[model samples]
Target chain A: MHPAPSVIIFTSFSGLGFGLLLFLGLGFPPVTGWVAFVFYAIAYALAVGGLLASAFHLGNPQRALKAFTQWKTSWLSREAWLSVMALLVMAVYAFCAVFLDTRLTVIGWIGAALSLLTVYSTSMIYGQLKTVPRWNQPLTPVHLLTLSIAGGALLAGQMTVAAALLALAAAVQVAHWQVGDGALKASGTNLATATGLGTPGSIRAFEPPHTGTNYLLKEFVHVVGRKHSRKLRMIALTLGYGLPVVLLIIPGAGHVLGLLAVISHVAGLVTSRWLFFAEAEHVVGLYYGKRSA
Target chain B: MTELPASTQKKLGLVIDLDTCVGCHACVISCKGWNTENYGAPLSDMDAYGADPSGTFLNRVHSYEITPAEGPAQLVHFPKSCLHCEDAPCVTVCPTGASYKRQEDGIVLVNESACIGCGLCAWACPYGARELDALEGVMKKCTLCVDRIYNENLPEEDRQPACVRTCPAGARHFGDLGDPDSDVSRLVAERGGMDLMPEQGTKPVNKYLPPRPKQDVSHDMDILAPFLEPVAEDPKGFLGWLDKALEKL
Candidate 1:
């Protein structure tokens, strides 16, 4: 809920990168030689860069290797394992596609599925948190996957396909906001419920636990104004979805237009991702008598 | 390793009485003092004694004002720490297997050596129990004072969490709640101890006793009328009689 910078960068770029890898693994754009090399390079850079950005947020980056071992329970662990598998598979597939100029259908298909699965695992890392009611929903994964695929399709230069996926992603984003905005209110948690003091009447915090900010306040009790959030959402809708859709779908929309669409979509997505964390209301805030929903 | 056991052998936890806590913060200070040295990493402080001071603390006391529709408002002091839940999401969400719930006593702990400090366990906890040590880059939380509780170094009577031992009001109790005959279990039954935010379904081991019902102490006029009798004047005069009458009133 902190809207941490490293996390925002990691989620945004990695989703797009993986989305592109999925398309490439499935043999989209049908290119070979230098053109294919450039695509693979961009995908790998984005994907790897995003992974490094994630590691940067860790307090002990050296210990991150241990994260791969807890896949049986932790979604973050699953994400680590899945992303590694997806990246490895994509690397081999890229080798065959660029060097041999022939896509191995089985390997290609496997890589594509793994790529998508990796993205899903990333989404699950947030979605599994019951403390943050805004993210604990089926729509979280839907939003992540749709946005990744749409962004991927755009970067892969598949204008027609990207347009349709962008539209779908936009719809999912809208629905996600519609549902997530009300999730905290729907959850039956309040200060009384949080403290197990359900009798008497409404509860209000008389004295905070500490005078200065603590880890909980910094990490879980973020507050974003409704007016600002509303304005950001409108900007996100216009740039992330609207402009990209109009630009990509217009007749005679050349490479310049496609690139512009990609830029606008990425910008819009950044805003959306910021909202994704800022708007999330952790249930722990109820203990402070903050908004429950 | 991150998965919780089917059941813990004993549910060792704290039972806090909200009715008696005086918000003295003795437990908070004692916990910080004992844990900062006892634990592997010190509970680091940033900008301490400055304009804005903050430090990692295992236990914290929060006060709340509860106003009933029919009566006056009451202030309640709440001391919070890890509940060591049976189905702890914090343990399950640990990516590096650093966070775990002890099978022997159901006491949740963090293996500091393995913690990557991604802070997921903190995010998963509803009580805001875990705090990331910014200096050490690791997550730390209340271990229920496993070191002190199991230590043979001190007197047997002192085998409890620093917070519980330091509580001045006797508001804190620690014991195995698994046994129905235990003192804690009886207290919970008698005092109607409750789980905080049960809907989260963590099945917390610790419990909180709600504040006692308030009583009205206003005197009725009719009951006091007979007691307000005026004294008769003696040779001293009206002043003496007036003093006696005022005292009676």
Candidate 2:
């Protein structure tokens, strides 16, 4: 609920796009010039997609420029400003690469920061929203940060360090997700306990206060209501994570591991993000007479 | 060159005594009265008096009967609207300049002209404070009667928010929350006030003092006896069929 696909795509693509550019510029070069150019274009698409999607969430997309004025206090405004700054950095880097030269020392720092900020701000957007307690925690930002590094690592050429970082991030992510799931369960238990109920069982009720479904229920309590999809979710995580590991080290992917790495990470992340939003319980859900699961 | 314009200063807000609010919704009606005429557009009722009655209101008084297992039913009337937080999240979340927290006095106002009618602020609010005015296609909320509070034509004391002015029980109070020594601040301090949803961390300036009036159930022993009946029997109204069907079959 805290994140939309625009945000998801922005963080992931920006990471890959900027990450590839930075890695090639810093560690390896000449050969990855082609990769860098392609990634810059990919990064641009993702960033613009994110910006457009974010605009829809705004009351006035045309007046979004005003967000730059409040960068001192608001994280969202800072995000808007930083995103624009990132685009400029990217454009300049591209220009210099073609004619003059993309300075590894100067533009590298900018690209790195752009990737970091793109992911960081995207994380902070949800991290700051206090209403959704699930997202308000620091783990939200940490998860996004790790995700950036993971995306960057997947784009690595030969260094085992990249794979190591990816593995470390995956571990942290799994641990954090476990903690989050525990927190969610604990809160549900606490709510049920507070109402003098023992283990929430079949607490469904009718009589929604509003006639038409409001945005809250639709977005937050978006239970699929189908048993089959739940099974699909389990498989998504398994295949997403499992296949990538197998493809990376099995020595069969040849030079194609890079592409597979990108696909697997994105697929796994999409599944995780979907579960993250789907599993969260809104306090208002209780008012509609929802029993704790 | 230094410029200083002479403008009358009035800190606008509402103070509801949780003890006295009878849940009759009189303030809600009066609020509807004032905003209907003064606001850019009226709060629309989707289906008035129908099966599905839902609409927008500047104020709504909710009656919650808080019953203590040891005692009787204590009806707590909560009239909720915009609390006008000192650090308003709704204003901050707005991607457009439509939502603004006025520096003049910390009143969170949404400019209808500039608003694109995005509901981000509504989600940001844990208290469900802001509502999108479907008729105007813009965000609308309790303005604290800003138009009337400084109308100048009305008497000095009469120029107050409709919620404060029309509260029959004198439960609602309006004053400057910024001033530490203001009446509203003092009332909050003296009454040990709490907020509607404090865990939200929005730091809402508006405070609701505790109203734990004990209700006596001693006189209604006969009526209350049924409440203690076995809850497992037929909460869903299916126990009768199972009991009768067994004998018939």
Candidate 3:
């Protein structure tokens, strides 16, 4: 897992953006006119900007339109379709709320559901990868969904709901790390199984295929130091979940505190998202003798 | 279109013999040479002669040392490429339907023209078989030399994968594994050819023949002791007289 910057930005911002859209679509803030316009603008910027950031990682961004065609099997395709639909539906809903001062309950509800589904689709893109054992778990979707909804509640200024959701997000994130820590070992894909050489007493990498690095090694064989990752986990938890919950729950917390909470949460989200890719041990790394699958 | 067919008509793949591979990497070079020239995209290299050289290669050979329970350590040269699995994850994970397994021959291939180069297919593969061409920005993989295998232009003997044709050790075998009676299938049956990472449940068509047990050659040194014995304990005739004369002198 390369912990690619484009993907980290894409996942973190898009999750937050869609989460906010989900709240706005359901009339959480219930604001009208320019206030509603500001909310919609932020949501569109985050969501659309995140999607565009994802395109930056693609080697051939020009052919990305073709990515929409394989939703029948591919989660990435499902994500493209879902994100577009969510954005389009939210646009219409936002227009009505901001300009027409009308609340169409059915359209808003549909948009909210689509927005949530878009985040889930994005999560599934990683969750479905059996090659990366850390992400191939029910907890993966649970973590992403909780984070998105919690972030959405925070942006909507629903302090009580945001507090509770942030607490829940913290719990899910911890549980995800707890399980993901041992996922590759639990996968039972060691060097022996990887090479089908188990009959021997033990197998060790005698020599590598090439002296220079290749795509597989560069992409999948990332090695994050244990001590460094531990420190990062603490930082992510304190900023992403702990601080936000505390800020939202404080008795006299005002606009400034709320803004600080949002900033802290975003910073935390980016850090954790970086860890998400960096810590994932892809089974393919076993072939390179870089790690135990 | 990313959905796999119910079953391919033929499971055409390679059966590699781990016992015979000498770790020469000949197949690797031959595969690169043939594929770059013949395949959809020339497998491009970035900073080929410079500091950080990296490139896309469909086939690669890795060497490993295995210590048997009772005997000495053995080195095995493992050559890996696309397994062309019956349940190929790379095919189903493709967002653009560019990656697909042939319903006719079971050869998994990327339609490079349609490829978005998102690289999800590469991530989905546990074998690290597919590589994205840095220059072309399209995925490259082993087509089992689809062009050469089926080409009417090549000689009948040359109608096989470039790696298979170029392997000097006769370690690489190619045929339909779907047919139980095929030479490859029979070889698999006799040698107990095993799939790599069977628990992944990809149901790989390719098989690997495990190296045969080795003999400990330490005891063979005793047989050469007879050659080191003196030809005669006592010299005869002139040689015996010369020996006594030299002793007197």
User: lDDT per residue, candidate 1, B159-235, as tens digits?
Assistant: 99999999989999999999889999999999999999898899999999989966644455367767776654362
- Model 3 C-alpha lDDT per residue in residues A1-293, reported as the tens digit of each score: 99999999999999999999999989899877999999999999999999999999888999999999999999999999999999999888888888999878788989999999999999999999989999999999999999999999999999999999999999999999999998988888788988999542388888989999999998889999999999999999999999988888889889999999999999999999999999999998887778844
**Model 1, A221: alpha-carbon shift in Å?**
1.1
**Per-residue lDDT for A227 in model 1?**
99
Report lDDT per candidate: 0.91, 0.62, 0.93
RMSD each, Å: 3.5, 9.4, 2.6
The true-versus-predicted C-alpha distance at residue A250 of model 3, in Å, is 1.5
What docking class should model 3 receive?
high
Question: What DockQ results do all the predictions give, each relative to the true complex?
Answer: 0.77, 0.17, 0.81
User: What DockQ number belongs to candidate 2?
Assistant: 0.17
Which candidate do you rate higher for TM-score, 1 or 2? 1
Write model 2 residue lDDT over B1-249, tens digit each, in one string: 001112214344666788887766788888888888886678776666777656677676554445444555555566777877755777777655667766666566777776666565675775556777655657778888888787999898879888788888888988887676899988878887665445444556667766755657578768966877764655335677676787699
TM-score of each: 0.95, 0.76, 0.96
Q: Highest TM-score, which number?
A: 3
Chain A TM-score per model, please list them: 0.97, 0.78, 0.98
